[model samples]
Target: MDLEGLKLETERLLLRPVRGDDFESWAAFCADPETMHFLGGVQPRAIAWRAFLSTVGAWHVQGFSFFSVFERATGDWVGRVGPWQPEGWPGTEVGYSLARHAWGKGYATEAAATCIDWAVDTLGWTDIIQTIDPANTGSQAVARRLGASLRGPGRLPPPYENQPTQIWGQTREQWQVNRLRLRR
Candidate 1:
């Protein structure tokens, strides 16, 4: 994909690949228990460092990963949101995980919609999915707001194989239709 130095912008957010400087904020976000409740519990700085490294590696190796999101107005590191699909993943996914402080502002929906457009148009993906725990009503609302439908239950690869998840999805055509709403 040659996404070198790729950066995408939303109305209130600036999205880019994770940088070396982002490790600290990313570690803090990963360490937040409340924020990590649905994300396999909070991790220590050591583990967060590994995850941060993996995130950076994915961009270079897989040519894509969730972009580190920042608030345009404040430049605060808000979260990560973008295309992600590792081995055994159900399908091409435009996933999201924002810090607690960044919740309830429609950033997930806005950032996801932007990524969905890129995934469909640039990646040439036919479909997209988001694996969310059933209890995560916030994410469900965001999926609905972005016009995806609940496809059914799903499971991830080992390590997270046992985690309960529901697959929400839509197609490229569906996103084009949904994009109309965003434009309106």
Candidate 2:
């Protein structure tokens, strides 16, 4: 797929591939302790750059990656949301990570929902999963809002083997049923 001009736009957001300019906000987001609480830990600037490269690299290697999100109204970088699955991932997953200031605005649910549709339709994904930390009620709520159910406990690949997570997901058929329930 030629992703050169590809982008997904919601009523309030603009979703597109990660860009070099997005790194500054992306780094700041990762550097913040609160925002990175459930997303590993606060990464230093150098580590954040490598992490940024990984997402950008995923697009080339996997042909798809999380979209860097920005509020259409103000053009501010909110965070990222979309497809993600590493070598030992339990299943195809659609995840969200947003800035602290972007919280409480329903952006997570919105972006994840959009990503789910794209993944299933464009990527031919049969089922989608989200490995969420149990203690992160905020993300759990977002998952619930998207009509995903808590399937069971999930484990990540090495380096994060000890971190706990709950697998949440639904089949493509279920998503069709649930997607209708959402207010467009």
Candidate 3:
């Protein structure tokens, strides 16, 4: 499906396609060691540029990719969160990465929940997974908050295959149940 026109908005965020002007923020996010610790370590600006391009390419090639998250109140680029599944990936996934400053405000969970809803409700996915580094407790917590349970070990596709990761996820049915509970 064509995702060029897609835009997902939550109370505090605007989830949309990555734009060329977002490069500086994206590069800075990639270069922050604290933020990149679980995301393949800190990358140089050049590497970050390529990674940014890859996300843009995924939108064209796969019709889905991480959406650039903007804080609605401040109009700031806070991060990226959404569906991601490259060739040989562990599973259809809804992933998230936020700039260091964006942490602790529930932005990750809020944005991820929106993405998860879209993946299941719009994309018709049966299940969604999040491959998180075991040491990244912050992300793990976000996954749990989203109603995902530990689904055991997982491996990244090439280049990142050696990294230790764990899968956390739930079926669409399970998510729907949880989503209802949250509203009540």
lDDT string, candidate 1, 1-184, tens digits: 5455688998899999888999989999999999999889999999999988988888889888889999999999999999998888988999999999999999999899999988888779999899999999999999999999999999899899999999999988998998899868
> What ranking of all candidate models by TM-score puts the best one first?
2, 1, 3
- On residues 40-93, what C-alpha lDDT tens digit does candidate 2 reach at each position? 999999999998999999999998888999999999999999999989999999
Error of 1 at 5 (Å): 3.1
Q: Clash pairs of candidate 1?
A: none
Consecutive 10-residue window with the lowest summed lDDT within model 3: 175-184
TM-score of each: 0.96, 0.98, 0.96
Candidate 3 lDDT (Cα, whole model)? 0.92
Give all candidates' CA lDDT scores.
0.91, 0.92, 0.92
Tell me the alpha-carbon RMSD of every candidate: 1.1, 0.8, 1.2
In candidate 3, position 143 carries an lDDT of 91
- Clash number by candidate, in order: 0, 0, 0
Q: Whole-model lDDT, candidate 2?
A: 0.92
